[model samples]
Target: MLLPARTLRFCVATAAAAIAVTVGLTGCGSDDDSGSATGTTATASTTTAASATTGSGQAAGATPSVEELQTTLAILSDPAKTTQDKVAIVVDGEKRATNIESMTKALAGYGTLKFVVSDVKVTGDTATAQVVISSPNGDAPPMPLTWQQVGGKWKLSDASTCVLLGFAQAPCTP
Candidate 1:
């Protein structure tokens, strides 16, 4: 079946929101590679900071919880949120503004679709989240989503959006 823009955007938005949660949970710093004993202390502080943000027992730099991710998706899907708000969660916000209306309309058709996070792998400022989408037709195979941490928020990478929109892997501006 053809993937409608709204449906694809829903997946992308969900993944992006989840990644953003990861950023908030993990903080904007990477683990120190120093073997010095003092570095261990620093690690503890990082973990404490992460725990404060997530309120879970998650260690510093750990992935976000599945529930947090799902919550983000739910918020984004709310019709009460403005188009500007929804677009802000997208990878290329300004570029996507023009198409938000059409995409929102398309979203109305696929109410049965569900997104399940399979795994999330983070490396530096980039992350790959695997998601399984299920609908009336059946469960779609797992799809790996690419996300980038930008200005302390997680957003979809241009490449991921391009692929989701059925474009070739080229240098996409949006």
Candidate 2:
């Protein structure tokens, strides 16, 4: 069945949000060692900051154009920025993965990531964007990405998805 563009977008967004929540609640680590544990916090912080900045909208005292968001997505999708790690913040807990380099390697053959912004809701320095990512293999489900403004810069607050395996978390409760 052919789904409406809006419906398709929503589906993708929902999937992304679900993944984000899952990864956020899960702990990050490999069975091998704990030396890399410290990397989790650092990576999470960086990812959160970058996501918030990229997805963020206008500041409480200023107005940022939509172009800013577009630019943010572009930068986030870049392979270079993908090294920022993957983290999720859930209602009950937080999940983080510091092995971003590994994740990138795994996704290397997955093809480029193309994000489509279906809709955006902005309030002050915070905003929730409905986005869908398409890969060479296929299109991923839609996901909700949260953003916040800090120091007049917008960054990702929570990707809601894209967490590493062990670092994945459960969904947040409504």
Leading candidate by lDDT: 1
TM-scores vs. true structure, each candidate: 0.51, 0.47
24 Cα displacement, candidate 2 (Å):
20
Q: How accurate is candidate 1 locally (lDDT)?
A: 0.46
lDDT of 2: 0.43
Residue 87's C-alpha lDDT in candidate 1? Answer: 65
lDDT of each: 0.46, 0.43
lDDT of 2 at 84: 41
- Residue 11, candidate 2: C-alpha displacement in angstroms: 5.4
Model 2, range 69-164, lDDT digits (tens) per residue? 544554433444544422322111133234334443443333344556545666666666655555433444655565666667655564333321
What RMSD does model 1 have?
A: 18.0
Which segments of candidate 1 are over 4 A away from where they belong?
1-62, 67-81, 165-174
